[model samples]
Target: MNKIQQFWSDFCIVTHKEGIEYKDAFQFGTSADWLADLVVEGKKTATTSGYMFYEFENEAIPQTGEYYIVLNGLEEPVAVIQIQSVEVIPMNEVTEEFALAEGEGDYQFWWNAHEKFFTELLKEYDKEFSPNMLVVCERFKKVYSK
Candidate 1:
C-alpha cells in the first residue's frame, strides 16, 4: 500500500480496535449528538445540566490532557479527559473515494471507537470515575506542511 493508504489503514486499526470491516465511515456529528442526547436525558433526573464544546489550537497536535466541560451543577467544571498524541493521521486520509465506499457504516464505527477511545484513555490516565465526557479526534494541520 502507498503511504496514504498505509496511514489510513493504521488509523482505522487504532480507531477501531476490533478491526475495521472496510465498510465503516467515521461520522463526526453523531458522536457529539450522542453526548448531547445523554446530557439532555440525564438532566431530567439530575435537574440542571448542559455541555459545551471546546476547540484546541496549536502548531502541533496536542497531547491528551484534562479539559473542562462546564456544568451548571459544579462551581468549577466537569472534566472531559483527552489523550492527544502526534500519531494523528492527516484528514486527507478520509478521501471521497474512501468515504463513499465506507458509507454510513463508518459513522457507527466512529461512534463505537470514540466510546472505546475515551474509556481506554480514562483508564490510561487513571481517572477513578467516568464523567459525562466526549472524546474528540482533533485533526491538526500544519501551516507549511502539505
Candidate 2:
C-alpha cells in the first residue's frame, strides 16, 4: 500500500473504528508531507465526539488540543474538530486489511454528528449562542486554539 493508505490504515486500527473514510480535506496549499486522517468510531458524547486520527512524516506530531477546519470538495469547511490528545502506538498495533470493502459518504455526517454532540454539551453547560453559529464558531475556536 501507498504511504497515505498505510498511514490511514494504521490510524483506523488505533481508533478501532470501521468503515474507513477519507477525503482530501486538509487546507489547500498545506504541506503534502504530513497526512491528516480522521476516524469516527461509534457515537460519542459532545466532549468526546469521535476519535480523530492523524499521521505525519518524520515523527512530527500535532500538539494536543489543536483544532482543524476540515473542508469539503467545495472548499467549504464542513466541521471544526480538535485534537484532545496524541498517542503513539507501535506500527504493529495496526493490523493488515485496513481498507474497507465499501465507502462511506462525505464528511457532512461527521459534522452533523459533532454538531449534535456539541449542542448537547451546550445544553449541559448552559452556554448561550445561536444554535446555528454555535456549532461553527465552537468548532472554529477549537481549530484555531492550536
Candidate 3:
C-alpha cells in the first residue's frame, strides 16, 4: 500500500478502537491543496459537484452516516469526515446557505468557482456545460485530522 493507504489503515484501527467506523477514502479539489486544509480546519463543511451519478453509476454517492478519509493534493490522508447530509440541486438552484456552508466565499464566489470547475470537468467526457445541470451537494463534519 502507499503512504496514504497505510495511513488510512492505521487511522481506521485507531478510530475502530474509539468505536468509530470509516467507509472510504478520497481527495478534494483537482490540483490544489486548499480544500483539504479547509476541511481539516473545520472551515469547510460542505462540497458540491456536477458529476452526474448516472454517468458514473459504479461510484457511490456520499451517503449520510458514512465516513471518508480526506486526502490532500499530495495524496496524503489529512482528515476523516462523517457525512451529515446530501442533496441534489440544479447548478443555478444552489442556495446561499449551502454555498456559505462550503466556506470558500460568498455565493457569487462559490458559483463562479464551481462554474469554472464543472466547465473544465465536463470536457473529460466531451460534454458541454449547462447552468441547469444537476449537482450533488454534500454536508459533512470533521471527525479527525492528522
Clashing pairs in 1: 24-106, 25-106, 25-107, 64-83, 64-84
lDDT of 3 at 3: 75
Greater TM-score among 1 and 3 belongs to: 3
Cα distance off (Å), candidate 1, residue 72: 42
Quote each prediction's TM-score: 0.23, 0.28, 0.86
The sequence of per-residue lDDT tens digits that candidate 3 reaches over residues 1-146 is 98766766777777674455567777877744788889989999999977584465667777898888888887778888889998888989989999999988999999988889888978887888899999989999997787
lDDT: which is higher, 1 or 3? 3
lDDT of each: 0.30, 0.33, 0.83
| Per-model RMSD to reference | 18.6, 18.3, 2.3
- Enumerate clash totals for all models, in the order shown: 5, 1, 0
Q: At residue 125, what lDDT does model 1 achieve?
A: 49
The best-first sequence of candidates by TM-score reads: 3, 2, 1
Flag the better candidate by lDDT, 2 or 3: 3
Error of 3 at 84 (Å): 0.4
Specify the poorest-scoring 10-residue window by lDDT in model 1. Answer: 44-53
Model 3 regions lying over 4 Å from their true place: 9-21, 51-54
User: Could you say which candidate leads in lDDT?
Assistant: 3
